[model samples]
Target chain A: MMKSRPIAATLAFVAAAGLLLSGCSAPAGAEAGGEKKLTFMFRGGEDEKKAYEKAVEQFEKDNSVDVDIIVTTADQYATKLKAAIAGKEVPDVFYISPGDVQAYVQNGIVKDITQYVENSDTIDLDNIWEYGVDSYRYDGKRVGEGAIYALPKDVGPFSFGYNKTMLEKAGIPLPDKDKPYTFDEFVAAAKKLTADTNGDGTLDQWGTGLNVQWNLQPFVWSNGGDWLNEDRTKVTVDTPEFAESLQWFADLQNVHGVTPSVAEAQTLDTYQRWMKGEIGFFPIAPWDLSTYQKLGFDWDVIPYPAGETGKSATWTGTLGIAVAESSKFPEDAAKLVEYLTANKEAQQSLVDAGIQIPNLKDMAEAWAADTSTKPANKAEFLEIVKDYGRELPAGNTFNAEWYDELFTNIQPVLDGKQSAKDYLKEAQPRMQEFLDSANQQAGN
Target chain B: MTTTMRRSRLHRKEHQAALVFVAIPVIGFLLFTLFPLIFSVYASFTNWNGISAPVFKGLDNYTKMFGDRYFLKSLWNTLYMMIGIPVGLVISLALALAMNRKMRGTTFFRTVYYLPVISSIAAVAILWQWAFNGDFGLINQGLSLIGIGGPNWLQDTATVKPALIIMAVWKGLGYSMLLYLAALQSVPRYLYEAAALDGATAWQQFRHITVPMVRPVTFFLIVTSIIGGSQIFVEINIMTPTGGPEFESATIVWYIWQKAFDNLQMGYASAMSVVLGLLVFTITFIQFRLNRRNQFSID
Candidate 1:
């Protein structure tokens, strides 16, 4: 018995460690390894994965190189990517964000690709959204000034969508396509539509169900309030206009009764309510199109309700296709990025999969002009993308800690426990500290 | 003389084999655990952004932790959730006492209690998240039967910690109970009989005999529970992705993780992690120091 005990114990431990090591390495599979191999990591849903798989297959065939696709869910992608980078198994090309450009450039994690784009005959710089392209431009001192580190994957305009059936049922006129509703008019409509449809002594339908994080930008911007000033050095969210806009957003749920309460929202969130035709309005991004296409209710897009400025405004978001600086084949990776971002076929496939609007202006215009889709006002998304859709304030800053601070304590305002003015007054200085630290970190 | 010489040689061979066996795990421990521990200490004093080279920052990251509201709040939240440890132990010990009896269907009840322990924490967290939904949740529906409206468990700042505590206690009850059960079985029956023979009242005999018998298990459970409680993260991330309502549910680890990956503040996170490691080590050291006087060393 003693003779075999050591072997058995050692074997058991080896087996256990083998399991752990194998499990850890399992997700990092390189399919059909070859001399010319490239790894592309990106985050999205099943439809997006399917779409990318097809596009990647075409790119591989065209380039005569092996491409390994690593698809991760949205929530876990950032963590997984960071782990990969830290572990020194960095993917050749991955989705990057503008907000991370300064730090990424400083770290040499991403390669500068200004020369590749300038030399490529297939890519027309003007065809891509200028703002989207500029978001990835980092000059070491500023984000949007110098050489490019990544190419825009897609410039997604966060559009406002409303339920047509609910509006019609409430005898409310449909929102105009070109013009936005004034805050008062929007509230009036919301109040009109928020009634107990089945007379169960409970609210089953609400005019709007907006999550503050994703939906408050339009109101704040339209009210002539912004998170940062022109140079992006100072936080300027403590203004009276910002407070008034924030108060109005809070009043939608607390005082106006237009939105679902915190308790009410905990059951079926605002997004679910919108899908079920219970909510009048919700924010819609291009990435949401595939999932939202399956919604039971008929919905259409509109500009968000205007505030004090009488102008519609909202944020545009984008993910950049970045080539890793440590890649064995950076030029190949850069070519793949160029193809993904600028190629007509790849952009069309992504759009056809309902994941995004086309990157090319000509294709986007043609796609928006088509009226057969569920959202008849596709032109509104186009208009926002083409004209007034501004980058989120976080995109301009060195880091988003300062941007994220604004919402950390703002729940009290939404809960009616704190006033917007007092909250903003306290918030700006705290944000400034993070901003200052971030600025210092960036050596600004 | 030949047999003796052969036996001694065999002994030497066995000793070498034993050393080899011990060395495998020792090497792994040193490489993975010891190396990381030492590296993190060095990293805590530097402005390492996890991408580029690190710059030395002296005590900046460490000193900054005190003034960070998020860090303080998260630390408080982590400690607040540790309330579950004591509550879990008490209930589990009581359960162990009850289950020690020759009862019907004891195995089934044991399995039922332990099911949560074996289940994946991610799945359990997701299930609890659904159950704690304010309006149409199982918890609120149960409360409605009693005509008492339950506040939104995971969303409301007042209840998020309590909700997490309740879940932690529930999930961990069976493991501690199992340990206590084992300890109870191992206790000699003679002590109880001797106590009863001395004309001791039921309460006194039970208290003196049973409680003393189970002291080792209690010590063990408390130390481990505190260590586990302080590092709580996965549930907070799963249930409240934005760090709960007003950041009430965010634990120290979750905040560290957010700062590291989300904010790209790896230096700050590494410093926080060092503090957490030291705190956990100190607490564990204190427990060991106190327990050194007690009987039944873990080794």
Candidate 2:
């Protein structure tokens, strides 16, 4: 009996120790058995996932080390990335949106690639847009000084994409592609589009549908109302301009009864609505053109309407490949990042897939010329991005939740349950407090 | 001395195997549960963003929690869900008794009613989201047909939580029903016959015999449902991304998620979780006490 007790206790101790060792083992980069394998994480649907996989396959063939690719859905990306980073098991290479770059960079998760960029023969940092580079930089340090966290691979430029057939059917003159109608004229056009064709009590078609997501930020920016001040430490959304623009937005639902309430817009697929020729004008990213083509509507791109600020501005989402600081082979990972962004073939492949605006300066025109692009005025689409586009602001707290806040806070105002003034007034202080608390917690 | 030693040896030998069998799970529970519970209790007293190292800040999170509007709203919402558990219990028990009869296709009917409980919460939440859509939803349409206008079911503040309650009850009723059905069928048939022969009506037979026989099962349902209902999260999370129009449908778990992820206030979130756990524990304890006291009378 004594002999068995000792044996059993020893076995139990061994089992417990085994579990603990498994839990605390070194992450992927450490204790390698072969040519170090680096993980690249991204989020996309099947098509984009396929493109990324193809790029990774090519990268693996060129490098001695194996490249592992992990793809997450858009909704799960932020949550998973946060957990992975916190666990200190982050992928060696990953995709980070420009808005989230600051958060990751500030937290010391990403390695700066400045030194690598300086040494690389293939990638010309100068050719990359200064504005685009600025989006990824923090306090004058380009993402991780001497090591780039990521290189810009795709640029999602926001612009107005209109249904030419819908405009023609409604007998509304198409706005100039080069000069979009003024903000007032834009509203008038929308009002005309809201009219019922069947003369039934219900309107079968609406003038336009606005996405309650990130799309509304452009409208706020157009009115010269910023969500936060330049320092990003204070919220500045309760100003007269913000209130007026929101009032205009609300009028579409409440007084003018032209567009659906923000909540109703949530129900409708904004891209699908524009594609089906049910809506005349839609604010969308150029990346959406591929999906828009499936509807086969006679559509074209237009510059953002000139707001009271007079400068036409559109919000942009930038995508890039970043290297984790804890990477096994930092040099190889850096090279791969550079190759994915700057390699002519890879950039052409991305453009060919109609995924996004490739970073190379000359690749801008090729974005429109890729054989896969079926838009009637593809050049005009690229032109809109080149001529008038502003990258989205970056900060430590910039995330999907920011837009969710805007949507939820402004929803009642849009529904006429409250005035825009009252809503924005309440919202500004609340958002400010949220950001302040976040800043305090982050020790900014 | 020899006989006592022999008995001790035998006892130790018998329990050693049982000890070996339980050792892995016990260690796992201690490490994953007990250790974290202790660590989080320590963390709850600190100001932690989860990125940097946590700094000790005694009682600050708890103090801040008192003024948090969303936290209070979620507490009230949790209390409100307590009402649904009893409503769920009565309906489920009634259905169980009906289904316990020797009817044709009884198994098929049971499967149909219990299906929602087995389905993924995400799918059910999504299905309900569409059904609860303010304007074009089937529920609203049905209401309009019956000359009763549906208040914007998911959009309005007052109606949103009630809409979630209806969904929760619908989702939960099946499991309790299955439990009660088992209890009903297990009751001896001779007891009902004896009561009937003694001039008992159907109602009296049910009141005197079936009710007593199912008292234990009813007690089980009440306890499990209360515990399950208090921790309800997936429906509110999946359907109402922004906590159901002004945070009306925000439950305790949903509030914990918002605090941890959205705000990155892990310290505050941990404090809230401790309070919620205690709240559930206390409520369940009181319920069990009351249920045991009433068990004999009901039977």
Candidate 3:
């Protein structure tokens, strides 16, 4: 009996070990709730939460309904939100990305809010940015062209920022607002900005430090290189223009030595360097304004340096506020979305809080015209919005795997270990494979 | 007859109480462990995207695993880290011998050694992440004191795995040292005296007496550590989130987690998980057999 006891305990322990083997996740089950309460989940920082809380407070007061706010950090948001959906305990309204529209629609997770949006008195579809609104539209096969699934919470114009003080110190003239600096002119300015002012045996100042994921877009687009062909069926990153853009991006660090070396940058990343007046150029977005307001150095947005196309380019990032198809109070949820997205007072509060660009065209134009803001080139954000802002290449695809592939093995090129042309030659087939798989999954 | 009937009723009542006690673990074992095992086996053969109902696809996920270089790389990385297990055991055993002597501050040393084992892994990983930083990190600064320019520990593909291994060894030293200490104290001193009288050298006495005496504890630690080490995720997740440079530091569990949660490829992740399960079970089963044989031969 004693021998059997030990053996049986060991057996139980082994069986218990099996628990972790197969259970990928045991998402929390549904919790009890009141009859009329709506769950609103989103990902944001404290300022965004406060802005949203103000808007939602009005929403609850006007509608006489309860809204339970479930805020999460951006990193954990996707996992938690997906777990909720998979468990069939989805929130009434949640923030979604445009990239997931196909799967969400296929799974009946998102409701078709076309009627709600069209009939919403506060939400004038015509007044909102067409780029923002159309991102949620999907026909059965194509994205960006059919019934709307969600409303835009905000349209984030990814803007280029330059240190005004650094330019003044270097005796460099400010860039033109009407016309972007050519690539050569930008590089020359960057070279002048790069110096060892502290004499620490290491260069303390850098021209620019750009991450490939976010900052590479303007360079690629202005150079007439794109990740996908129009009609969105082919992987087109293997073009010479793309290689040239990529090599130039790398050359800023490897050839020109304008940006910080990898080892130096590891200690303090480019963003931190820019914050400390060590980096001359960085990317800024609407979300950064609240933090950037407290900077020790003066800075402002500029047109991205131009390439062969002779025009500035950047991508607009938008978060979609969606009502789940299974939501108990779809009308109230839709109203909240409309209010947060389009109501003048709500939009004004959000814009003043520096959480977003205005969704309404007239309000945005007015906001851009006011030169009192630190950016001083708010019109550049408007220009991108009205003319040059494009959706990221992944936004058009069924899944982002193909687009994400561009950066997965890009270190070799960026580190100057491999030529950009050689890297792209190898990268295209892999990207094509993912794109083809995505197509098949979408039943294309 | 009346007395016997009353006794029988009391016996039945006790039997029912014991049954209730036994049922909890059995039910948990079935629901949480066995059922998931069966369901995942079924899931491994499907194309479930975690959002929709699974569609059956025979042998595709398995065949793909063979060609998946990331899967192979992660598997290799996981096994490569097990090199630290034996190295850690050797060091801890030596520490255990030193600690077994009647020395001052043994308890203080014990506490210090075990501190990392008790510390929350997330917090330790964060501390280690900064400590592994190239320029300003604690590790590099120490190396610079000795006139060696330390490479970037976490960022460089060549050094990332070794950095992780060092951290693992340091964190695990305390627990193993404690176990070995307990095993050493239980060993009869007279055997060592007899070996000494027989003119056995200190090293020979250690090899013949001390090593064999601690064999069972060693077997236990090895079995448990191998199992525990294979499921290493939190440190990898917190430290090298994007799997480090060139995916060099990516372990099996971290990759499985990324595939399952981030990519929503639950079906493929399940297949990978089942393979890991089989690998762990096979290794454990072999160890058990070997250990039983050793015990029998000793007898």
> For candidate 3 chain A, which ten residues in a row score worst on lDDT?
A22-31
Compose the digit string of candidate 1's lDDT tens values, residues A1-444: 766577667768777877787655543224346457788999988888888898899999999878888899888998999989887788999999988898888888999989999888768998888888998998878888899999999999999988887888778999997889999999999999898999989899888887778778899999999988887789999999999999999899889898876645443467677877888888888888878878887889999899999999998898899999888887888899999999999998999999898989999889888887767888887889778899888886767899889987787898889999999999999999889878877882
Q: For model 1, what fraction of the real interface contacts is kept?
A: 0.54
Query: Total backbone clashes of model 2?
Result: 8
lDDT preference between candidates 1 and 2, better one? 1
DockQ of each model against the real complex?
0.47, 0.36, 0.25
Query: Which model scores highest in DockQ?
Result: 1
Model 2, stretches more than 4 Å misplaced? A1-26, A99-103, A140-148, A261-263, A267-272, A369-372, A377-388, A391-406, B1-17, B141-152, B296-299
Ranking 2 against 3 by DockQ, winner = 2
Winner by DockQ between candidate 2 and candidate 1:
1
lDDT string, candidate 2, A289-388, tens digits: 5676677677777776766776667766677788888787888888888888888877767766766666777776655666555555566545544655
Candidate 1 lDDT, B1-299, residue by residue in tens: 99999799778767866876788789789978999888888889998877767789999998999988899999989998898998999999989888889989899999988899999999999999989888667998999999998988887889988998889999999999999999999988888888888988989977888888789889999998999999998888988887888899999999999998888788889999999999999999999999888766322
